[model samples]
Target: MPAVTEPKLIAGNANLSLAKAIARRMSMHRGMSVSLVEARVERFNDQEIFVEVFENVRGEDMYIIQSTSNPANDNLMELLIMTDALRRSSASRITAVIPYFGYARQDRRAKARTPITAKLVANMIAEAGVDRVLTLDLHAAQIQGFFDIPVDNLYASPVFALDIEHQFRGQMNDLMVVSPDVGGVARARELAKRINAPLAIVDKRREKAGEIAGMTVIGDVRGHKCIIVDDICDTAGTLCKAAETLMEAGATEVHSYITHGVLSGPAVERVQNSVMKSLVITDSIEATEKVKAAGNIRIVPTAPMFAQAILNIWGGMSVSSLFETDTLVPIYEGLYQRS
Candidate 1:
């Protein structure tokens, strides 16, 4: 957080709003003259990808801000070709500024002969000549090991923690942090610690893709306020179900927090009708008009966080301190204690 030399930024065909916000945080305007051209991308009467980068990026330290959210293949290719273009143009260094890394859930071979697609994506990005990576809230932390180059995985909890303090002044004690599923218990526990609150877990099972069922409460929920935390909320399947279960288990009120807001399918309608009092998510992915107008959903900004992270990397500062929480582990130990 001290004075340091700043790096220049360049962008591709990504989330221009978030990119501009990041630029504003750094006290710079989006660069001019450079363009991201759609390079000969045709379906070719068959399905395949072709790409080219039209501008020269010679001797620059380029940062391509692309989120591989929905329409994953197109965004992935855009990132790869943009990096390749910068490399070929003789850019001194390139960093992929991915706010939401796609396919991160397929981190390991869950089934026999299954592919580790996350590693493959890392390999592809590295092959495209990216010098390093800057991403946020990867589905699995282990995916950082997939990259050969330097990888900085930033956290959104500090931003959320600050907002929670501002949003619920003087009533913090009534709050309880809830993880919508077993996997996210650690994250919810961390947030609970930052705010100095209790933790609860929803033991839900995935009956099939896009289908969530069986919510079992792991801790006391009678009359306590709830805030469900997750890494991503795509279909609203698990989130809504968990909120319903918590209400049934006697929660005073229910709210949800998520990292990426990929509100696809009937998600808009699902959230519209759910028992959740509200849902909050970060602006890593651009929300649609429906997501924007949805009465229950609110968006938190990530521009300042990414801006600080960019500064940290370019200035040789430690990024790990951003998390500032040993809180989650201790809370988990308490919640799992023998009855």
Candidate 2:
């Protein structure tokens, strides 16, 4: 095989806007002029995904930017088929850059006769001929083990921390990070430590997924500006309820910083009517019009960080350095200041 020179970005329909943003950000980095590969990812009359690479990809480093988000099955299939196409085209390396990896919440079998869909998705991606995987804020960190290829699981905490600082700059003294459930204590605690704030947990009894039976605050949130941290926000039922519970526990104001805004059924409506002051999410999953229209929802762009990660991977640099708070704070601060 010949030496791979530059990274070629290929995007599926899952999140085209984010892909473009990543390309644009990459171009801005130290005169590295990167652009998306000329490819067609369309569908046939039977809804079968068809992918064609217009440019020569032989021996090139290819990064497929596709999130397995809404219409999960279709987007996932597009990724698989695109990987197969690239492998057949003799690409030297193929990396799947999935910003919002769907089926991540199903990492384990919670009940008998159920399958671990997360592992299944990982297996499918590997079998499709991807040499590496880059994804953000997986629902369960252990999902990395499911992949045979090298996996880089990036966190949104550094990005979220900077936004929280900018938004609650003056009120940091009275800020508290709240985990919506017991399972998310580590995530919330990390953010709390980043901002030098206290941490709290919302102990909830989930009778089933998306349904909260009851919830109680594990720590005192009295007069504090509470921020809930979680990975995915699907229906927003639990998020809204957690905000209300925090208020009842004497919280002055409530906000949320979730990684993936998988705002499915009634999520926007619920957020609009909830007691939360704001719900900040990343551009991992493309925002819907309803989400864009929501008064309390804000989206922090993750493009610069991802673009840097791609560059580091291509240059054989340290990707873990991007995870440090000091490293990303300036990048995010500059991004927010520009906008």
Candidate 3:
């Protein structure tokens, strides 16, 4: 269709801070005056969601920044309703920039009669009139296939790598990257390779969701400072146990860098009392007061990286190149300075 002047950024109630941060970073690019769309996303007394766009978005490219985090259904509905509003307003294209895609843990059917809710959520978004999707560190990469539209899955590895470099500058040789479970070995390996450190795995048996039966270390962690890498930290049960296991296995220290910090239930208390020295997470999900007050927990902003991704998408450039060594180094440095 028609050429648009600049990207229209929209925000929902899920993560307003992140949306504002993204808007600021986008404004920094090309000296463009970018700001979030003035939309009223409210709820009725009965808890029904309502949306109203105050400004004209007709023939404009729209990006809605919302993370389906806590109260996943509510935030998800906000995104879908916003998408429908943009479509009806005749917006050229609508992209849902979901920093954290909740209900992603139910991506597959692990047992009989279980629903694959991830696919259902994907279908809902596609049907709601979103032209594309942009999310970070999906629980399962294959969830991209569930969406018929273009999907951009960005990683927090580059951000974590930079922080790791800065935090463990001279102790690189004694550093070890760890996967808390077998499934996350690949994720942990990537970070290990980035920092030129060794990789380790905590082999654990799960009796049920959120419960670990037994755990054992697969690689030698003796005399090394361990860094556990994973996609999501929901309850912090497995994560805390893994840290304890690593410490008992002769590891000098244990630290973790997880992308999405769902931190449900007793996660904060567990982390505060755990053996891990620190826990670094991205601002994919808005931090709760408990999480913010936790001494060991630190958040790195994903705004600059996401802004670059949006800029590239609007410019029709390659999104995958954002993770390149040369490209990410600057991103990491910027994140370092911001933190």
In the range 1-339, model 3's lDDT, one tens digit per residue, is: 323568889999999999999998888875978989998999999999999999999889899999999899999999999999999999988999999999998999999999999999999999999999999999989999999999999998978888887788778899999999999999999889888999999999979875778999999999999999999999999999999999999999999999999999999999999999999999999999999999999998899889999988887888999775558666545545423
Candidate 1 lDDT for residue 220: 93
Score every model by TM-score: 0.86, 0.96, 0.97
The top-ranked prediction according to lDDT is 3
lDDT, candidate 1, equals 0.79
Using TM-score as the measure, name the better of candidate 1 and candidate 2. Answer: 2
lDDT of 2: 0.91
Total backbone clashes of candidate 1, pairs 3 or more residues apart or in separate chains: 0
Write candidate 2's Cα lDDT for 126-168 as tens digits: 9999999999999989999999899998999988887877777
Error of 2 at 98 (Å): 0.4
Local error of candidate 2 at 276, Å?
0.7
**What are the lDDT scores of the predictions, listed in order?**
0.79, 0.91, 0.92
The residue-by-residue lDDT of candidate 1 on 29-51, one tens digit each, is: 22333233223333445655545
